[model samples]
Target: MKNNLTKLVKKANAGDKQSLELVILEINDLIYNLSLKMLLFPEDAKDATQEILIKVITHLSTFHYQSQFTTWVYRIATNYLITYKGKKSKEFAMPFKEYAVLIDSGQSDTVSYAKNAGELALLEEEVKVSCTQGLLLCLNSSDRLVYILAEILEFSSKEGAAILTITPDNFRKKLSRSRQKIRNFLTNKCGLVNSENPCRCHKKIDFLTHQKVINPNNLRFAQFTKRSIDLVDQIGDLEKAIAIYRATPAIPAPETIMKTIKETILIT
Candidate 1:
């Protein structure tokens, strides 16, 4: 994918309009998904995605074939996110309502969580997904970006450094610090990380439902295949820690989001 995208970028840079459009269309989901993960809001993610693509197009000539196209593309994205601040997630809350119906309808039965539960309970399960994503907001934008690149997105330290335009050593240091921060936060506040914690997902369901923040019938994040956070060898039982963070899903932007990106690209 990266190689092909690099080719498209080269074509687009040479002034091929079709390749330009194709480049934006093909990477729309990737940009939007990253934006959503960083901004934690659909509208913001949409706007940011459009803005980033425009920036990418405007700066297409700046890309020297030195790095992979993805690295180049994500550098633009991570840089924008590093300096860009949108909504304040002073508390970890997600707009589950925006995603619920779409996700629930498209959920695969092969996915375990979607199968054995009633609608409402399943929706509560999805809250865990949003909750995990929300945790990214706790870190400053740069740290969050690093964590997203290195941990959630599974970028190697070298690849992450290339994307962030930092030295590999600097990238490793930042990644280590970011990892520590998240692990500490989860260890202290999340029941999943330490089973003895009082903060259970089930316990929050009633409060969340009564607060009108979630609707079980229209579940979202819970339906996708869950992914664990990158295990830091610095901490607890590596296996258990892995299992805890693994429960969080690596969510993709929905088709609607992809369509919205396409429309935004056309309009711009």
Candidate 2:
């Protein structure tokens, strides 16, 4: 991988068309995955990914050899997200917090959006994505990025610090605080992580269905081709809730952005 990046960097710098295309293909997944996690909506993620790639390609000549290409690329991506203030549309029409309140209240009118148990299971998984992504937005951008990089992306403190242009110690400290904050929220609100919690996926299905937060006919987050991101085997001493958060399957990059990037590279 390192050698391939080195070769691609050299060729791309020399304005080699095929090498530039390969570079886009190789790095698009990393950039898009991070974008989707940070932006929380597919359209927003796609836009952010395209912009970040443009910046990376345009500034490739300025990238020093002091850091790995991936580190430099992520630095560009992270900085963009940190300053990005775009508003993303909510996955559900009603906020997940409000849904939680309705769940707490006995006033929710039950409706089954899913026709069968199997479909309901898929919808439940989608709910997990919606709930978790909503919680991520609650954090300030920097903290959210730290949590995602250190926990979900599994970046080392050094690598994360490099990407954020911070000291490793600073990275660890922020990661610790982010971890604690997310854990507190999940333990108090997520039934899957804490059985004592009142919020259960099954319990919310009816409320979510009634509100059109999730449609059984049109599931977004859950897909047949991909499995839920699982970190069960990668579990560490970190909070169980965080482990679950890290385990959530990352959204796939859209083909549209990938094609656009290739076209842009070829034209340039």
Candidate 3:
């Protein structure tokens, strides 16, 4: 695959549109699938895919064959995912709805213009893509990035760190913290804590953890309830993070993921 990719890259660099499109077509699964799972939103996934492809197209001439072309491409995809999440987080944290509304000129009057099945399919794809957009709304971009890479996508900490331009140790630390916050939020809202009972007192919850670091043997799973709970118990020798969060429920409401995906895939 690498050798074939190298050939494709050589051709793509020489201005062969077919070769360029073919290369992207071949790797689209790797690029888009990873982004989709990571972003948990189809629109953002599409956006990340398009952005990475654009970078690949523009920088084709600069690619040094020192590493597998696939590795270079993965790195490009990772960067775009990270940047996309950053902007998305800003929007999620503080949405600009009125500004956004001004931009939607209106839907095309397809019936009057003579409708086609392809147009309907395109609309359907747009709707499905919206799911990916909202998937990471519960997380901050940093947490979203790590969770996408480390948890949902199952990238090892080392690999996740490489893509995000962070040290593995730092990535792990952030992952733990982020997971803790997300878990706490879920438990509070949905009562989905791994505990045996929901009626457990806030005292017990306070003593439990938000997110535990994955052990060398247990990194395969995202939710490490026991380790995190133990760590919380250790920390709350006086008081814990969970107790504090539970004490004050956060203010509510959200962002739109579909729009992000369209921006991502279409890139205009």
Q: Could you say which candidate leads in TM-score?
A: 2
lDDT per residue as tens, model 2, 1-268: 9878978988988888788778878889899888777766777788889999999888988876777888889999999988775556334324436644654653323436666767766876777776676677666779889988988898999999989999999999999888887787677777767778777666677666666656677776777323343343366676668666666765668889978876786674
Candidate 2 backbone collisions, by pair: 229-247, 229-249
Instruction: Give the root-mean-square deviation of each candidate in angstroms.
Output: 7.6, 3.2, 16.3
- In terms of lDDT, which candidate is strongest? 2
- For each candidate in turn, the TM-score is 0.75, 0.87, 0.49
lDDT for position 246 in model 2: 66
Question: After superposing candidate 2, which stretches have Cα over 4 Å from the reference?
Answer: 89-111, 209-212, 224-238
Give the Å error, residue 78, model 1. 0.6
State in Å the error of residue 80, model 2.
0.4
Q: For candidate 1, write residues 7-117 as lDDT tens digits.
A: 888888887877887888776778877887887766577778878887887888998998777777898998897777665443443333432322223222233233445
Where is model 3 more than 4 Å wrong at Cα?
14-16, 37-41, 85-135, 186-268
Q: Candidates' lDDT values, in order?
A: 0.66, 0.75, 0.49
Q: Candidate 3, after superposition: displacement of residue 105 in Å?
A: 32
Worst 10 residues of 2 by lDDT: 224-233
Candidate 1 all-Cα RMSD = 7.6
